[model samples]
Target: MDEFSFCDKSLSYEVRVKDLIDRMTLDEKAGQIGDTALGVPRIGLPKYEWWSEALHGVSDVGQAGNHVTHFDDVIPGATSFPTVILTSATFNQSLWKKIGQAVSTEARAMYNLGHAGLTFWSPNINVVRDPRWGRALETPGEDPFVAGRYAVNYVRGLQDVEGSTEDDEVADLDSRPLKVSACCKHYAAYDVDNWLGVDRYHFDAIVTEQDMMETFQRPFEMCVKEGDVSSVMCSYNKINGIPACADPRLLKDTIRGEWNLRGYIVSDCDSIDVMLDAQKWLNDEPYYCLDLDCGYYYPNYANTSVRMGKVKEAELDSALKNLYNVLMRLGFFDGSPKYEKLGKSDICSHENIELATEAARQGIVLLKNANQTLPLKSNKIKTIAVVGPHANATSAMIGNYAGVPCRFTSPIDGFSKYGKVKYETGCGEVFCKNESLIFPAVRAAKKADATVLVVGLDLTVEAESLDRTDLLLPGYQQQLIQQVSSQSKGPVILVIMSAGGVDISFAKDDPNIQSIIWAGYPGEEGGHAIADIVFGKANPGGRLPLTWFYTNYTDMLPLTSMRLRPIESLDYPGRTYKFYDGPTVYPFGFGLSYTNFTYKLVSSTKTVNVKLNKFQHCRDLNYTEGSYKPPCPAILIEDLKSSCGDYKVKLEIEVKNVGERDGSDVVMVYWSPPQGIAEAPIVDLVGFERVFVGGGGGSVKVGFELDVCKSLGLVDFRGYRLLPSGGGKFVIGDGVLSLPLQINFRR
Candidate 1:
């Protein structure tokens, strides 16, 4: 092996991968296609497992069973941060990266102990297009910009070398050794798992090219181009008529050719099987060059296809090169890792545990704090009642795709730290179908100084393959909350512990329900985090990443309608905060902090001039008569591609904490395109930054620089990005503050 150039650590990954591919036989190349790679042992290449999961922690949920062990003597468990939806609520990119770093650290440590694999299929960056889609818990919510930013930061933290800067250039990624490999998964308009009679495997997502470019495909584009991710897992669903795994337009043309993805394309677990058996995509196409992540028949099929002249050996070599390149980047063939010293001690270290707690604290959204009824003084509140199925939750606190946590702190345990506690499961479970259980919960609430009703959906209510039918609380859970709140001795605090948004407008309008908190599967120390917020130990700053729509909204809207723009003639309200104009239970970016904060626009660019080239077609169009109005013709962004770099919008906003307590506030910037553009969003989030401001009179200045083409541009019906020539407004945080601007196109 030492005589082989592939064994040399100093050689480039490309050269080394090519050498290794040249040495391997046809059978050996086919064997390396699946998740369980059958290495060329004769050439000193050992077998490797390419499948593992680290969504929020070192999880053992992948095809490689128990890869990240918990029962082991040396390492007990990994630090589990809050699930992606909750984490995204924090609106903190730095925190997202930090959590990613912590998870990868434990992953590398586990790898050193030979307890885990280097490649982890994680950070599911699929936008949560619908609330009923069960896996919303795993995504960064409904915004494409947020999801894209999450992919970039989390991927960088997972793949970059331990000491490398977070802002490392994409050009440098190819040469650098990876700490661990991270894959952005379930690509290309894949949000559904199972809905009514339709499941992800069989359902075909009929999406318009405009909606695809504007929303569905934006995150994956960012994941590939900006994140520089090592791998992308095609979804089980079909985009239009073609299965995602088998679609060359998506996998080859878009991801590789256009985005220039410097990585391998792998199918979701058993997605190849789904395509062949369920979708019958293989029978019609008879293509055998697709990449498989996990399946039994790949090697045999590949060997058969190569002999039958169906697939070229060179094409097989090309795919193998990609697979081996990833392994090479992970230092698989380069001997022991540089951080080989990392072991059991690094798995659940104190710092990692603390980070988990902090993550939960930051992501807990305070939906309602009516009349400042929260922050129950521990001294005044002598006896508190912790009632609900999730009151003493153990595994429920950690949503799906979770591993063994380092420890657990139930809601009962957390509130007990402040005062004497009385506990009762309001319902036997989150299902809460039985009315008899509510009596005991109401009795306990009546006897306590304050009642914390920890009620909401669980995995049983919403999880993989379990799409919800309604947006309301399951069964009798809503009744229990109402009963307890109406009869409680003191203020009743409602705590929702689920992934998808609940239409809790009943409780929102109820005076009896003083406060409400959405703790979306806050991992491990979640209970403690919720208690801290309730007791004023931590200020709640998390905003809703996705809008909480009314129950009636789902009644009219079909989950299959992938269009994002509202169709007035059809009365289709559309999807997400970007387009939907209907009433909402809670709008996106809605969260109440313990204190108040105000935003003031300090400075901003009033006009952006896009100088078009001489040969462009749009430059010949006449300008409109009115001031700040668009021209007679629309200007496609492709025509002014070269001039995009010349125009940018820069602004500084001062956020002052006007309340009596210090707290964190997210400064969100939204853009409303020129009014005349057809099918444009109402307003969409462009940039956001979370900052901590001290008590009364304290202020923090936040700055943002947005490209005119990428940030302010509108996607037209033809799927082309168009720079509309007219006046627009940059809305800052909840539409209270805004700056008007004009975009002009000239030759």
Candidate 2:
């Protein structure tokens, strides 16, 4: 191996990476594919670790393993923000972008100060398919459209500086310098976690072609092309009979061939090992360590596979090129001028905290408010009872995989300044019951003007390794809630906190439970944010990210079943809001605002006819702009790649606040498929927007222009995406407005 023009700084990324690769020995090159890498110091390459965890803030995992350098100016710990579930509840894309920016800011600050690297595994955009999935707290909720939009907005913010020169904007994604690289992870239908007889780590998910393409893999496509996500991490499970980390159909055909991810592919920790050991899909050969320093066994088998005829060396080159390409964009070899300019003070700036607070304020859903019992009038409500395990809990506010906050606020702390606050330890554990003081909690509720019952699942019951057995709150929480609700003399506001949805049907039925707040692990400012909403300092606008399933949600399907669309043969129900027709405690995309908002469709749908012969090759609908072209097989093309953008339509709608109180609502746009299409879900979310209306009066009209060919329509079993030449109705604001759907794909 010989050194080349890798540090030249003036060459194209592709050219430089190719030149750099040309100089490496096969073994030296094999060392670079895993999470951590060995340095070719002779060639000036530093030992770089590709893995960094910045889910909600700059994490300590980014710190150097050897203490090679230190960041003195940056805060010791990054600011912990609300979990993605709570963040998605906001339904505000711009806010998501700011969060991405904040996280990137902290990440860059660490990297510049030698605390971290440039590639961050963050903004987990996986669509929460099942409420039982332990990592739902890490994802953006059940709806793929919302998740995709979040992916794009977050990537945009994470990748670029807000006030850069116009030249920066003009630079196409490929040619531009990245602030930091963002990863969209555990790609395609890797949602479920273990505990109940089925383990996702070794399960073979029988995902159908339609479910695989539409529901599971859709967000990754959006992240790749729209967000230009830097890398994709394969999952721990197997799709069909193939391990995700080794599936060429998924990693190569879909990601590289069709989706044009334009970045490296990473194996989830020891995922490749599971293929050889547990799944036994790969034949046992002597396992060689990919990185001696890292001691990973499976990546070497992948290396062996590449050296032998099983995996092509060209594929290895592609993966290597993608990884090197990202490093080049980050200017790692050139010494980052961008990184140097960033300081430790950027870790948890005031602006970051402010944005997070606003996000928490908006994302905390007001699930129920009967007879307007909320926004307690301070003069009328002199005494407030805040009681529960979560009332004064710090960990309850910050969910899993978060940075340590400078200080955390609890519900009791949040409500203290609002009234004469009285707090009683109602329960000891979020999941277990140590409710010996249940009588005292009831007494406190009966004595106060209003009772804020803070109760819900925490990390112990709902995080990575702990998928709950039932939707009901664990232990005696339900019993405790009912006991306190029955005794409360005044309005009872049930505040449930969890990353995943919980069944609070009992509280919903109780007339004494006048209001319910879904404050799913609202981070550092959770207390203040909750206080703000209760005091009317901030209107509660956040909505449910995932459905609050009925207690029998477990009975609907097996935890290991990968199907998102139903199988009539087995009486299988679907996974998400789109396919699941089962009863829900609270529907996906459902939320309550203090003020009522009315929606009206103002624009008419138009029909467009395209001659099939003129457009024979259709771009894969969910794939990138000009990629994924085998063309619609039935059609012939005169101009093969010139005009695929001709299949879009626009719809406009007006929204108004009808209530006397001011509030905001997230207007969701959905598409109901033509009946009898077994592949289609009952309704799929297509688009959404957050709108604000004034107290008693205010209106705003919004328009959505959808690519009929790209976002919606029909496809063959091959996952070759193409719009149904015949169009269908696009529903706006749930069912408030519906328009005609008409598209003619004529041959």
Candidate 3:
């Protein structure tokens, strides 16, 4: 076999790529488009390795001593990373990139030692909408800007630079430059996907043009334009009346045409086949047995209504090509040797475990604190009751896509190292239908000095392809909290670790619940990390990645609505916080810290005027309010309109950490038209920056750029882009438009 790095050569390398493509038969080419199962041995090609899962680690098959990993609910010792939503809360781009690199590195080690290359797909880029949807943890929360920013860094970490230097972190490499190709999944308008068992195939969500672009579509654009994702996994539901796989406007025009994405597009495993069967059984129209291209049909249901054309051949070809081209780029056709057998030698190393511990520490979010009742100073606080199913379960700490962890520490194991610790399994394994333990759990709380109730959704309860039936934790989880808070003798700390958001309504109003921490499935070292935060060994800095809801499932739009609604009706689907006009239990990008931080609107118009001062003498035109739009530099062809020149948007912001301890804060900028511009949604995310503030005070400026103005042009209800419309305003804390700007449009 020959060793070749895809990065080594240029178009000259395309010769080899072309040669491989030419040698492959049509079946092989098609096979390249659709990934195969974990163990399928084809003649010329390596066995299909389609089981790579990537949240914390590869969720696919990894081997132990001499045996291959099996599909069991519980793997003895697996390291878990915080959920995607929770990690997003950190707003750490560097960490996201590192996660991508690390996940791929470990995956490569497994592949080198005889595991498959097929990865469990991850970084679900779906905008968090309707907290009730249950799978919110899989997303990067509700803001498109945040999701997009994280996507770019994550993709860069997972994928190798087509032509760049080698990373010292990744040990083994022959010629392959890319660690792994990350796929931006569930493309456009796929937030909920919460419906049970095959029902999502027929679910169509109707959204307004404004909501679609502002909320759902914005993230996909970021993933394509900035992230440079290598592949995309189509959603199960339809947008408007068409399946995502067959939607030409989304798959061809927007993703490929407007965004210029060059990656392969794969169906969500059997998603194509499922929809095909749905077109046969669900719709009253006649059924034709056609391939993905919808050509060469065989009649299935004849008598009643026999319409032949449902899916177009062109659509099928486009989808297939989308997937095939990506494989060609991956060198899947180079006839390489399959990986060999792996052993415990490839298990969690000391260094990797340390990295995992640090990651857990950085990802924890401290949501609330009243009198700074944390960081227990004395061992006199002895009676500590660790309640809730999550308190003692080793598996609860790590969320989905876990690796076999070398060390397993539960909250019970961790807290016990300090003083006396009492344990109660509050709820069963995250998803059991039982709820009788509330009274007993509360009774145990009554006997303690302080209580740490670890709770949240079980991995089995919510995940990709599986939608949750309810928003609140099932059984007596919430009731149990209410009961315990009402009866507990001491202060309470609530810790949650689901892949999705939990309704904190019960704990929010209760004065007894002193603090709330969102631990988002912090991997193997999660328990130890939680204990550290509780005991003041580590400071919690994570924030909320998505919004929280106050009520039941029906209060929000169904995930299937994208497939069921009409295209024109979609403009106002009210999916994300951007479009949702109603009040929320919690807003997007909202989170609390133990220490206090102050935000001040410092300056406005000074910076904009200063920038325009240089352009005053330009010969382009007079600098009148009607003709003073910002000009883009010639060098930045596509990125020209990134900043705003309108006099309306010149505002300055300053932040100060007034508390005694050091802490970090994410400044989120949400903008919306004042009124009557284009019937805009409530608000849209424009920009955000994360900064660390020391004990005294620190300040930074978050300016609104012109490109933000141009990008906000997705809402054109009247057909023509508004030349002179409503101006954008800045949001700080719970305050809206502490500093407002005016729009100065050019004629």
RMSD of each: 2.2, 5.1, 7.6
Candidates' C-alpha lDDT: 0.85, 0.75, 0.60
Q: Which candidate is the best by lDDT?
A: 1
Clashes of each: 0, 3, 43
TM-score of the candidate numbered 3? 0.78
By lDDT, the better pick of 1 and 2 is 1
User: Whose lDDT is higher: candidate 2's or candidate 3's?
Assistant: 2
Candidate 1: C-alpha RMSD to true structure equals: 2.2
Q: What tens-digit string does per-residue lDDT give for candidate 1 at 497-615?
A: 98889999999999999999999999999989999999999999999999999988888778887877776677888789988887899999999999999998899999987666667
Best by TM-score: 1
What is the clash tally of candidate 2? 3
What is the clash count of model 3?
43
Model 1 off-target regions past 4 Å?
A: 64-71, 166-173, 282-289, 619-629
User: Per-residue lDDT tens digits of candidate 3, residues 288-353?
Assistant: 221122111111222112224454434334444444345444555542232123333444656566
